[model samples]
Target chain A: MDNQTISPRQFMFLVILFSVGSSILIVPTPLAANAKQDAWISISISVAIGLLLVVLYNHIATLMKGQTFVQATIAVFGNWFGRVLLFFYLSFLYILASLVLRNIGDFMTTQIIPETPLQFTHILFLIVVIWGAYLGLEAIGRSSEMFMPWVVLLVFFFTITLSPQIKMENLQPVLGNGIVPVVDTSTFVIGTPLLEMVTFLMIIPYVKDGKTKKRAWILGTFIGGAILTLITLLCILILGSDLTALNTYPSYKLAQKINIAGFLEGLEIIIAIIWMITIFFKMVVLYYSTTVGIAQFLTMEDHRPLLLPLGMGMVVLSIIAYPDVAYFETFINETWFPFAITHGLIIPLIVWIGLLFKSKKQNKTQQEPS
Target chain B: MWSMISIIVLALGIFLLEFPKLYKKNRKKEAWFFTIFLLSFTIISVLESLEVELPNPLDLIQTFYKMIGF
Candidate 1:
């Protein structure tokens, strides 16, 4: 497992890319719908909460220093229960990956390439993801390092180019409706993307230097969350809260609004490119983790064989995942918050407690022998 | 019909490319998993492309949500 180690810097880029993921294009609309003018504040709160989750995930990673999340689960619980839990966790990851695939597929069909069928878009994306995962984490890590700089530059480009449309009055009356909406929005924001850092636990063991592991996790999460917050602020500023909330892809629309003396009139291509790259990274991370985790759980020597079949399953799952965009939105709005909390927060919390007791017992036994 | 044939051809191409290695490695269980998964996906894609109605996975979650009164 340690045969393929990635540098801390690459790890950080992966985290940033993973956190940005599919959430970048779509997250702001929900934030604006929930928090209105206070969307930025909601995102800020999510960042804070996200950092806290990073800490908790780091603690669990530290407790079982060299084990993947699946290994840790099996170590904490006996094999039978652990296998059951691992199965459930892996299932959750696969479902999430499929949904993400569906997201980009939906984005392409509805927003960019309406004439192209959704399955083609999905199959094309999955092909890249399958190949990336086949190359394994090291390649994915290096790819992130190479691409993250451009992603950052593009983000800044959007921020600066769209500056003319930003209205200070749009963000006026902050907390005028009190902090309820802000808090409400924060839960959705944090639960959806921030706490999804739980998935990173599976990759933590591959970091070369244990000392820098926690720092990379925290820094990556914070940087990613900050970018999200900045984008949320930009959405609110440029489009105003009402319009931002109304649009499906607020950031994409915001990109369309970028008119730098008519030179960059149609910048949605740039936004689409950003989304494709980030979602590719995101899906690869999730897909890699899912395939590798399944291989490990099943005691298979190679995860590559699982990729194509599982990738196919994912395409089908993505199709069946939602009947339409409206149902998808309803899932995000209603069920996803609790679902994310249960998997991301509650399960990890239990495992952490179990780890604490297991460590304590080990310490006591070691002391008695001494 | 054309899309369905293309999907089947694609599945067969991928199967031939991938399965030999797994067979040489003596990974029978994995090979079987791959075979079944690929076959099912091909069928689903063909059915979907043909506009045949199929059960959706989303409704399961929706049912769970309803049960929980969410």
Candidate 2:
């Protein structure tokens, strides 16, 4: 009878697809550049952070039982304060959604459809987001379910196809630049993408198998991180750390580099399709989540009606928000990690701690019978 | 501007589509807030599409990050 229940396997699929979305496209190169061939080291460090977030998300979810993170906020903060906190959360989510849309739009223009107007792809992407949202959470869930196999299959193909080009010599003297740069890059690498799991709190309460949620989140993150680590490792081997960081889509480039005795060339186009599909799933998740969050914040029963305009708005916002790719690059490097941490990590931690104390106090009160 | 026409169309379309769901006595205050919130996004989207000058609130914030060197 519980409508909100989502199986752990389904949740895992969502996590993997969602986790790989934008991060896979842009993160590998710079992270490799930053830490040299030891980029996987940074990924490992970031993945540890992902594990921490699993604990945090599970802690909050278990406390709230079957309610979403939004409901839990009210439980923690009461109506007025909870509502206010929710507004902030909603705003952050909205920004994240818009940023993702922008990133995907820019990526599209640069790579996939250079001649097509950015607005066209951005708007089309948002249309998919609206369609997903309008069809309801169940549609979003099912779509992720359907996309999971393709996403996973393509990832393996992408990795294996690039195998011939991989040069073990490229990985010589791993951590060649000393641990300092690795550590510095680790903060962003681990902090930004892995740190993003804090948003899972929003989905936590809606997750069934509450006891197994921690396991689901941890395993899911590890699976996603493993894919990323493999990709980064391959990127280093194929392109060398120097060349890897120069290209925007290193994995795509890796696919392009494949010739396989002239049997398989221009695999990058195929990889781009896979990348776009996974990215769309991720964007839709974020967009649906933001709409749901805002609807709940504003006390709306259905977020469906708001989806179209929000999607439309996001496409436009994507263009205006950053001056160009360089500015966008700078914002991500210099700006995003910290903001992501505060909103995605620290604030959620505060919510968890608040819930913990409140639960403890409630337990005490119940025991005392006062 | 063309953006104005687009914004009006979007806002009007949303108001029409959502009015039935939105204008109910059983509705929560948040429903009203979300409706308006969404409507405002339409305006923001239109102005942004038109390439209107909007404040970059993150400049100072980003500058600090650059200075700190992350």
Candidate 3:
């Protein structure tokens, strides 16, 4: 745990790893299902949604003027109510950890090791998260920093490998059914993976130089968003609209299709490993944030004690939140709209807006009589 | 069964690792809320995972993809 301040580039790399990890592998399959060949609309729409949330988060970050979410919560809302709102934030984080871990667990059983018991993989993932947290923020930061290049490079390779199989014509008719479906799917786009960027605020204050903080976070986010859009387009081009919809891991299938003189067959497993690695980092980041934020918000001296209960809680919640794969993905697509928007969009906006007024009033007073 | 025991034991060990900070005054409600929420969250996720049914969005997705041959 080197207390050395993080450069902006390191944080940006963390964002790239966090953003591309989960969204790249399987996000397009669901988006393709929702948007048809029109899944491109979902990614584009989610991009707007992601950016909108980023703007909200940025506004809150700016209003706090370098305060972490913990410090800002108390400053803007006062001690008690701030704590209440933070509880909600924590709950949202818990749900997020649950969902991501559960998704990872599902993927592991389905793709990585089919015979291994689901519970075993689930618990094993938790062990990594818990152990990782024990090592502290620097560990997560350093690991994300280290692994990001390989993750990004592997993704480009996957996308390029499927380049030939991608039938550009499969994406035709360009909004043929009209704006209604595209916009509807776009909301689905917003609700699913992209809006989760609200968690980035937790990491904002930790940026070593306050000057380049915004640029670093946005760099990470936009880069991640770009990767998502490209993968969605690639999946649509490769799998058409139907089978892409049918398969749970359509992006993996596209990578599998990259056969170079028949020797490159089954390379999508490489992509799946990429998915697993990147998502691992994403979960670690979110889980780490949850523990650290709670510890800080509660005024604890350290966050190490909270990791296990949090991990166990996530596993429990992931199982409880969605009944089956269809419902799991469904919860992600539809039901999560209000849930995500409330936490991801609505609450953050309120906190930021409220804090903005608070700062202005204080600034005005500071200039007046003193 | 053995794995579940390990998870619970590991979780408890992890919780105990932070025992010194648990007594701090500022973090009580937070500790309470987190403990309750985590417990509740886990129970619900485990129970829900056992139940079976497709959410409507998935069916719609499948149908739409099929209609478009996508």
Candidate 4:
């Protein structure tokens, strides 16, 4: 278990999949609602800011080299305070895993399989996630590597087929409402999938090559952000801002618009497939981190034993996490940004500053020649 | 009632599957931790199956942000 490692390529695939995860389905709607025709602009700006955030995360990873997020916190803050912080961080990861589970379950129930119980969808999904985590990171990495091309092919087909429907006039009077709305909409975009990339810190240490890891991290983010931006642009161009904002799953609807000579129609399932694949890897990564974080927290050797129980907890939490879609919407729009910021930005910044101070103290001690 | 029974049975099945592995290895601490987590979650699952009220965790974040005036 200790010797397990994933290649830089596999790491990149996981990052790409994680970035594109739930955002592919839901991001365009809110962006369109707030920024209108300039929603793509909002995402582009957020992607830029998200790049900087990734740089910050990379720096923290370098500073605490070879330590997982849990270990890094404990290393930086000392035992007691670190454990306290770890408690909050662990809960954050756990809640996030549950939320991601809930996201898919909700999507399945409302969009794809309306008659199925949410619990059934959640259980089936958790079984796969739990099994992936049980197999450990190496298997997860290999599987992601195998599945990467399919995700890319599906996304490419979805985009190319929808190209014919894009209306140039939908993006008329660019930034017409001024940059204010675009910037405002970007706040929501930055919180999700962007700040949420901070979770990748847990897996960064396990990537095999030290030199290429940073490159993989940044490139994966860039590609994922580009894919998301393309999808958002298509939604606005084809569906228009009003209709895009109206639909809960705009991209799913966008896929339904695929009509190649009126023969290749109803490829909406392509969107569903792409979303399910990305979200599965995303949840697996999160679930893996949560389980591994707990095992490390408990000073245990392996994380597999905790998988089933934690998964059961996740199923229950996923159901109760959002009473209905309305509350979930409010939470994502109103509350998620700040909550994500606390864990993603503020905590990492604190740890980075702490590392700097510690290193400076070490320099001072070395100069004293005692 | 059926939901409750199924939940309990599922919990027991999970326990049976996992506990023996820890027991065979003589990992007492690991076993204890596993039992605590499983038991707590099982109780929650049963409560959930019964349609009992369970606090949504995200509400904590929402409340915190509200207090901070976000």
Candidate 5:
């Protein structure tokens, strides 16, 4: 594969965008349902844990020494076993890309344009995602840099406009339940956009400068988690835990609550725009990783050729990803956390352990030869 | 029927757009890989357009996790 490098700054922006991704819209609902008024605390705890996860990912990247995650697996595990393990990893990445695509389709169809067929939305969004993937990581990174300011500004305005609606009573009885629920909710939070940072292992090696790569990864995650926490806190404060938990898209509803003296009523489109931009980057990152993973797996020269076909496949997979919204919710609440942990934590931990053994063996051989 | 036709046309369009470049470069391996992926995805798209009851991979994951009591 030819070299494509993105500066650590651009890498940071991508991390921030990807971390914020679809979580901004949907995370509040589950968090509020589980943790009630303490949902923000749940997110805060997850952010701290997420930082530690980033450190683990950085250690894996340091060991990789410029190899993509796909290549690293093969180097660490030998060809056949690595490829077997990689098949599972690649499937997870591919399914995740489709799932993200399906999310856009689901949101747009249900919320914005109810009349549009879900497949049409998927195809339309997939076209842009495919284009971004074909342009490669450098392009994806540059675009994230360009779009980061708008995301930040929209999120800031979103929080500021809705501040007046916040009821202190909404957050009363902070620990009314217990710490267990808070910790439990935090695990769910960690499962999502946090653990999914494993995908960044594919892109981290492409980032120039080792120290900045680590710094950018952690900083980007911090900012992203902060944005999510603020949004979740706003959801609880403005809409109250019950309504926030009940609604599928509380953050969007929070945006709609921005009346601004009755003149600015329907700025929910701001939420839509923010979600579109952030999810677009998120899907692009996931789609890029899937394509690159497949290309590297097959030992192909360029990943570009696989983009269009996979894009089509993703549309179909997404359509069938969840039969309905209820199933999606159940999958998220129950299955997603363990599944994510397996791929995001356990497998990488095994790879890290393998690296240690390999280094130790190399040291022993060198000493014996001397 | 129209959905099926559209799916096929879309696949063919992608093929036309990408195949020549791969062919020109004589990257035979990539060309073959692309053809296989395009063919398989095209077939799946057709099946999906037909509303065939294809199995969902996520069900398998859920089942496996449930079996393991996670």
Candidate 6:
């Protein structure tokens, strides 16, 4: 909105970081619980579904080039209804940012710093998120480029170092529980993490090149989804299905299991830092989208005026959102799936269809005039 | 007591950081909105610090999930 655009490469890295975000630590356990040894299958299915979603979002972006998702929604839906949809979109993104903030807070307080109050972690983290966003998307994009290599290297290190613990026996009897569980877990994967790429609809317009934009979305989704799949597979192979399912942060547990000589025993710190860095990128991107989306919805010329206040709102709402991680996980499993479908899939599909009709009508009008 | 103090201090810091830019740009409406937003958070923090019960929005969502048999 400020005439700032991120390069396609930065967009790709952002996608990779955002998709990996908390999922590295959060997704493995749930997938393990549902799909057991076949959790990787769930991830693969979600990746396929996620790629299609990227295509759908790219199609919509092509239809409404040179506009943020909010502007494009208004263009298609007209004023009042469009305004309503904009509010819905804003709520979706804001809730997402708040939930992610809550997640980092939960992770830190429960796992990393048990003595520290959750509020402290939320506030401390939001400070950076607000600052990164205040510098604008370019700064965020550039920062992601700076951090991506280190994050990737750390992940690879964890994976290779933990290779000794991976037992082929852990993946025995493939599809032992039948496809139901895999499908069920894949639904969770699709609804929660993958379809959450819908937020990128708000982001893709900022890519400077059209060709680069298309490739970035498609390639980024697959690469990101692939990373998640690998992580899930690693968790299953190393920790076994029961331990993977039992531990809340199975990937973190896998990190803990990296006992390559006694010297490298406690490497969860690297995993924590990796999660923090990726989550920071994800939260900032979502927070920036919410602020810009709201400012546009309100017809404000500058979004800066709203950044800090909305950040305050994010911190407070995060506190108000979940009583504890257990409830939070339950909400994800039960409520989040349908909610994601409505916002992520159904809403965007409706808008795209509306755009199609609008384009056809305009073409007909031009033909009649000619 | 500590939480309340911290909330006030944080709110003040936010005001200090952001208010000048708004004042410099003559953005009165934005200034008021920011102040109000900070004030509301302060109140919530104070209430939370005092251990007063407050309804959480996420609970409402959970209730909706139950109502839908989810």
DockQ of every candidate: 0.54, 0.48, 0.17, 0.91, 0.92, 0.52
lDDT of 1 by residue, A1-370 (tens): 4368888899899899888888897789888887889999988988898898889899999997688888888889978988887776887788889989998998889898899978889989999999999998899999998899999999989888888777999999989789998998888878778877788888989988988878998999999989888888988998899999999998898888888776758987888888889889999999999988988887777788778878777887788777778888888888887777778888888788888999999999999988
Instruction: Please tell me how candidate 4 rates in CAPRI terms.
Output: high
Q: Over all chains combined, what TM-score does candidate 6 have?
A: 0.95
Cα lDDT tens digits, model 5, A252-366, are: 8888889888797999999999999999999999989888999999999889999999888888899998999999999989999999999999888988887778777878999
- What is the TM-score (0 to 1) of candidate 5? 0.98
Native contacts matched by each model? 0.49, 0.51, 0.22, 0.89, 0.89, 0.49
lDDT of 2 by residue, A256-311 (tens): 88786778678787678777887887777787678777666655666666676666
Instruction: State the displacement of the C-alpha of residue A83, model 3, in Å, after optimal TM-score superposition.
Output: 2.0
lDDT-best of 1 and 2: 1
The residue pairs in collision within model 1 are: none
DockQ of structure 4: 0.91
Best by DockQ: 5
Residue A182 lDDT in candidate 2: 80
TM-score of each: 0.95, 0.92, 0.86, 0.98, 0.98, 0.95
Kindly report which residue pairs in candidate 6 clash with one another: none
**Residue A237 lDDT in model 4?**
93
Docking class of 1: medium
Q: Cα RMSD (Å) per model?
A: 1.8, 2.5, 5.7, 1.3, 1.2, 1.9
lDDT of 4 by residue, A1-370 (tens): 3668999999999999998999987799999999999999999999999999988988888887788878878877888888887787788889888998888888898888999999999999999898898888999999998999999999888878878777999998898999999999999888988888878888998988888999899999999999999999999999899999999999988888888887878889888999999999999999998899989888888888899999989999999998889998999999999999988898888888987787788789999996
Which residue window of length 10 is worst by lDDT in model 5 chain A? A354-363
| lDDT, residue A73, candidate 4 | 81
lDDT (10s digit) by residue, model 3, range A91-160: 7776777778888888878877899976668778888988887786677778777787787788778877
Candidate 3 residue lDDT tens string, B35-67: 664556445444444553424333443455446
Question: What TM-score does chain A of each model score against the native chain A?
Answer: 0.98, 0.95, 0.94, 0.97, 0.98, 0.98
